[model samples]
Target: MDTVPETRIGWTFLTNHARVLTAIADNPSVRIRDIAAHCRLTERAVQKIITDLEEDGYLSHIREGRANTYRIVPGKVLRHPAEAGLTVGSLLSLLVQDESERSPQYAHVKQ
Candidate 1:
């Protein structure tokens, strides 16, 4: 009997920074361990990404007991030249679907 070997899939183009940002956007007060699990990265890597984002003014964190509460700066301009003058709000608008047309889980979360 022959058994199939497990294959590991690696990320292609998406950066760790992007993954961290998306994770934070989804849950403002998500734990670092949760972020690592969601992003398939190590805790140290997630911590580095969080530090980078904070230093770049993309995110601001408030220490709330043991958990850090994160706030995104939606007005910050994107760094790419092609995206010049575009703010985080504009980018999120493009990504977000119409709430009324979404599934119950998505709709419930918004409310």
Candidate 2:
């Protein structure tokens, strides 16, 4: 039996933090397991990222029964000095994939 190696790309446009946040934005009640799967990270990694985001005041969640409903602070400015005045909303807008990108023939033209 042969095992396929992981596609370890050097880097991506968005950080894991950003990816996790976007997944939460898409579905507030999403499970950490799903976010991990979407971000290609482990469940433990996703949990840590959520803790970091919450500690930094970018994210907050409410426990509703057995699920958590996440709330993103849209007005929260980015951490980097270069991204001054850029809000969380701005970052998430760019990360969200469009309908065209889902097409089989759509080549992801690097921006």
**RMSD (Å) per prediction:** 7.2, 7.8
Stretches > 4 Å off in candidate 2: 1-6, 97-111
lDDT, candidate 2, 1-65, per-residue tens: 01223657697677899889987876777888877866789999999999999999999999988
User: What's the lDDT for all of these models?
Assistant: 0.71, 0.80
Q: Write down the TM-score for model 1.
A: 0.72
> Can you give the lDDT of residue 8 in candidate 2?
76
Residue pairs that clash (backbone atoms under 3 angstroms), model 2: none
Off by over 4 Å in 1: 1-13, 95-111
Q: For each candidate, how many residue pairs have backbone atoms clashing (under 3 Å)?
A: 0, 0
Taking the tens digit of each residue's C-alpha lDDT, what string does model 1 give over 1-111?
A: 012225348745546776678667666788888778666689999999999989999999999877888888999998789989998767756543455553332122221
The worst-scoring run of ten residues by lDDT in candidate 2 lies at 102-111
Q: Cα deviation of 14 in candidate 1 (Å)? A: 3.2
lDDT of 1 at 20: 76
TM-score attained by model 2? 0.79
The window of 10 residues in a row where model 1 has the poorest summed lDDT is 102-111
Best by lDDT: 2
